[model samples]
Target: MTAVGDARIRRAVRAREEGSDLPGVWSAYGGLLQHLRIRAGLSQQQLGDAIGYSLELVASVERGRRPAKAAFTAAADRVLEAGGVLRVLQDEVDRAKLPRFFRNVALLEAEALSRFSYDPLLVPGLLQTETYAHALLGAHFPPLDEEIVEQRVAARLARQALLTRKKPPVVFVFIVEEGALRRFVGSDAVMHQQLEHLVTCARMRNVELQVMPAVRSVHSGLNGPMVLLESMDRRRHVYVDAQGVVSVRSDEDEVSEFWLRYGMLRTQALSTEESSRLIERMAGEL
Candidate 1:
C-alpha cells in the first residue's frame, strides 16, 4: 500500500470528524472514474503511475475523499481512453470544492450572460492574482484547513474563465469602493500585484471595472454588496453574500430592485478609464 502523507491523512480525518456535507458531485465523479479504471483492467497503482500521480492521491479521488484537480482529470481521461467524459465534469467538480454557501450562486454566475456587482470591501474574486488569493484565504477566520484553502483558491481561479468565455459572450461590470482597494488585504506587495491585475482585467473587452470613491459616504451601494446577473435563460437574478451566508433569488420584484441599485452604483462610481488610472497609481505607491 502506498503510504498516506501525514498532511493528507490529517485533513481527511478532520473532515470526517467534522461531518461536513460534501457535494454529491465528488462521489459521482469518483465512482465514474473507478468504473472506467476497472473496465480498463488497471489497478489503482498502475493508473496512478501512468498518470504521474501518487497512488494515495488516486485512491483518495476514487473514494471521494478528495476532489480531483483539472490536470488530474485530464490525464486520467487521456489514459483511460474515456473520450473526454471526465473532462465534462471538471467545472462542476471544481464548483463543488467551493464553500458550500457559495456553490449554487457560483454555478449560476458561471452561466450568466451578464454580471454586474458592487463590492464595498475587497476586490472581487475574478480579479484576484494567485498571491492575493493565497493571502486572503490563508487569513480566513476559524482557519480553513490547508487542503481546504488550496481547493478554494483553485476553484476561484477556475471560475475566472467565465470572463473570457466566447461562446456565450458574457459581459461583466465590477464596482469596488475606493476605500476597499486602499485597505490592505495581505500585504503591500500582494495588493500591488492585485491592483496591477485589476488593470489587466479592466482591459478585457467584456469587463468594465469602476471604482467608488471613498469620499462618497452615502450611495445606493452603501447598503452592502449585491450581484445582478442575467442567467442563460435571460432571467435576471440577485445574489447577496455576507459573512459566508449566501442569498440568491430570481423573483422579478426583488431582483428588479437590485438591478436598479446596481445601475445607480455604476453611475456613481468613477468611469472605467479613471478607475484604471487610479488602480495604476495605487500599485505604484505599494
Candidate 2:
C-alpha cells in the first residue's frame, strides 16, 4: 500500500460510521498538502514556519489525521508559492468529489506523461463515460442515494477530460477478459453507447487499447491488474487498486517485474486492431 492507503481506509470506515462521504475530500486535501510541500522543497519545520503552524499540524494534514480548513489551504497556497495550484484541490474538496483512493490516482495522472493501465473488471476512469460511470459507482456502493450517485458520476466524467486537454497524456489500457464488455452495467442502450465510445477513444493517437482474450491458455496478469505511470522526469510508479490503492516502488527490480508482467500480458492479448474489432462486434450485439 502507498502512503495514502491506511489513512484513506481509516477515513472511509469513519465516514461510514458518521453517515458522511467526507473521507474522499479529506484524502484529496491530504494529497495536495504532500504535493505542495514537496514542490516547495520545504521540510516539515520549514512548512510550519511558512504557514505559521507547528510542524505537527502540517504532518497531521499530510497524514489525513485532520481535516484541512479553508484557511490552511489558502495559507499553504501562498507559502508554497503555488499561485493557485493548491486552489484546484479546493474545488474537489468543496464538492466532496473524487474517491479517497482515486485522489492519489488523479494527482499522478495530472503529472504523468504516460500511463499503463490494466483492468480485470471494468474500464478505467479516463475512458469511462458518465452513464457507464454512474452504473459502475452504483454497483460499487449500492446504498448511495441519487444525489451522491450523480456527484460520483460527475467526478468520473471529469477524469476523462484529461484525454482532451492541450497536452494530453498517453494512455494504455489492457483488458484480460472480454466478459467485461458483455456484462451490461446499465441498460442495453447505455452499454452500447459506452462500447461505441471506447472504440472511438481507442483510435486516438495517444491511446492504446489491447485485450487478453479468455482463449489464452496462460497470462502473466493473473496476479491482477496494475497501472504504471511514467512522469516527464522519467520516474516510474506502479499502482494497483484492490480493496484500496497500493503503489509499487520505483526501484528497478520492482518496476522491471511489472514491466515484464505487462509485456507478457500484451503479448498474450489480441493486437490493438483485433481488440478494436472485438469491441465493435460486442457493441453491435448490445
Candidate 3:
C-alpha cells in the first residue's frame, strides 16, 4: 500500500462502513476489497501482514485513496479466495495508472506503421531513458506517491518496446529542438546517459533523428510540438498535447497540413549525421 490522501481515505472508509455507493472505479474496487476482507474474517492489519505491507497501507488502499498495484491485487485475490475476481481488475488498474488522455495515443502508437514527432520542450517519451523519465515524473507539481511515479515511469518505458520489435514501424522520425537537448533534467550524469542513448537510437536503421538548431531565426515548428502517425492501412493522424489537453486528428486536410509542416522542419533541421555529432558532443561535455 502506498501513502495517499489520508483525509479521503478516512472518509471513504466511513462511507464503506455506512454502506454508501462508491463513486469511481477506484472507490468501487476498494469497496469490493473491503467486503472481501470482512467476509474472509481478516482485519486490515492481518491482511497487511499477509501481504508484506503495513497496516496503514492496507487501509489506504481499502479506502480508495491509494492505487492498488497488480502484485497487491494478485496477492489479495489468493488470500481472500476471490477466485480471480480481484485479479481480473489488474489490467484495468494498470491502464488507469497512465494519464487518462494519453491512453489512446499509446494504443495508436502500437499500431502505427510509421511515426514522426517534433518535440521542443522535453525528450519524447519513446526516446527517454529510464533515469530521465524517473526524474521528469518525480518533479510533478502536485506530487505523486512513489508508487505512482514508478508506475508512470514503467508505462513510459514500455512504450519504447515498439522500436525494438522484430518488424518495427517502416519509418520513425524524431525532431528534437536544440534547446531541449541542453535543458537540464535530473543530473549531469543522467543527461549524459540520455544523450548517449539518443545517439545509439539514432543509429537504428528505421529511425531518423534530427535537431532544430538553436541558431535558426525562424522555423515551421515555432507554433508547437506535433506527432504524425501513419497506420498500416495508409491513414494518417496527428497528435498534439497543449498544456494538459491532448487532441488526435485524423482529418485528411489537417493531417496534410501537419505533414507539410513536418517536411519543412526536416528541411530546416540538421541532418541525422549532424544531430548525432551534436548529441555526442553534448554527452562528452557532461
Candidate 4:
C-alpha cells in the first residue's frame, strides 16, 4: 500500500513539472499560427510547402517544440496573412530563448544608447560567434538539452542585431582579456573564425574593441565581467555576471564607480587599432 501511494505522488509531481515546463509564449504563438492556418484552410504540410520549410519543421513550430526565427516568422506571417500578429510576438519569443537571468539585461541593452563591457574570461555574448557560443554552452557543467542549446544559440545571435541598429546608432565598447581570445571555446577553427570576426566587428564605426594583455599583473576587471549601459535619457546602469549569478545596479554612485573602473580598464588595455591588429595576428596564428 505504501509503494502504491509513493507511485501516485511521483506521478503527480511529474505532471506538475511538465505543466510548468511548457513554453507559454511559444505555445501561444504556435496556437495562433495554427488558427491562422486552419482559418485559411491550409494543412501544416501545405503551409510548410508555401513557406519553403519542411512539414516536420512546421509541425514542430505549431506544437511550440521549437521557437520560430524572425525569418521563419516573417515568411509564415506573409504566407498565412497573419496581418503582423505573428511578427509582433517575435521579440517576446526571442527573449524566451535566453536564460531567465539574462532577459532583463537584454531588454535594457535594447534601449541603451551606449554599451561598454569588460570581459575577463569568455568573449561577451554580444560579440560571440554562433559556433563559439554553441561550444561554450555545450560545455555547461550540468549539461543542457540539445534543443535548449539551439534555442540559446539562436537567441544569442538575435541579440547581435543591436550591433547594427541605426537612426542614432548605439555605440559599443568591448574590452576582452587576451586569455579569453586565446582560450579555445570550440575547435581551433572556431577560435580562428571568432578572432577574425572580432576584427571585422571592430572595424565598425560605432564599435571600439580593446584587448587587455595577459601580462597585466593587476586590474579592476580581474574581479569579473561587467556591462555598462547608458539609456537614451543618459541614465546609467551596471551589470555584473559571475559564474551563473548576476547583479544589476542603477544607483548613480555604484554605476559611476563601474564607469570609472571601465574607463581605467580601457586606458590600460590596447587601443582600438592595436587591438584589431592583435586580433588579426591571433587569427593568423590559429
Q: Which prediction has the highest TM-score against the true structure?
A: 1
Per-residue error (Å), model 3, residue 29: 3.7
lDDT of 2 by residue, 241-261 (tens): 777656556787888889888
Deviation in Å, model 3, residue 218 alpha carbon = 2.7
- Segments in model 3 whose C-alpha atoms lie over 4 Å from true places: 1-24, 32-43, 77-88, 110-113, 138-151, 165-171, 204-206, 231-235
Deviating ranges (above 4 Å) for candidate 1: 1-20
Q: For candidate 1, lDDT tens digit of each residue in 1-286?
A: 0133234334544554367576666766777788788878999999999999999999989877799988999999999999898898788888988888898898888889999988888889988888888899999998989999999899889889898899989999999999889979888888888998999999999999999988778889877888888988998999898888788988889988888878888888899999999999989998
Please give the TM-score that candidate 1 achieves against the real structure.
0.90
| TM-scores of the models, in the order given | 0.90, 0.68, 0.74, 0.86
The digit string of per-residue lDDT tens for model 4 on 1-286 reads 1354345435534543378564566776776777788878999999999999999999988777788888999999999887897898899889989987788899899999999998888888989999999999999979999989998999999899999999658999999999989988889999999999999999899999999988887987878899999999999999888777889999999888889988899889989998899899999998
Clashing pairs in 1: none
Error of 3 at 35 (Å): 5.1
Q: Which pairs, if any, clash in model 4? A: none
> What is the per-residue lDDT of model 3 for residues 1-286, given as tens digits with 9 covering 90 to 100?
2233334445555664466332244564676788788878999999989988889988987777666877899889989888887777665555555776787787777788899999999988899999999999999989987977997888788678788776645579999999999999999999999999999999998899999999986999998999999987788999999986999999999989999999999999999999999999999999
Q: What clash pairs does model 3 have?
A: none
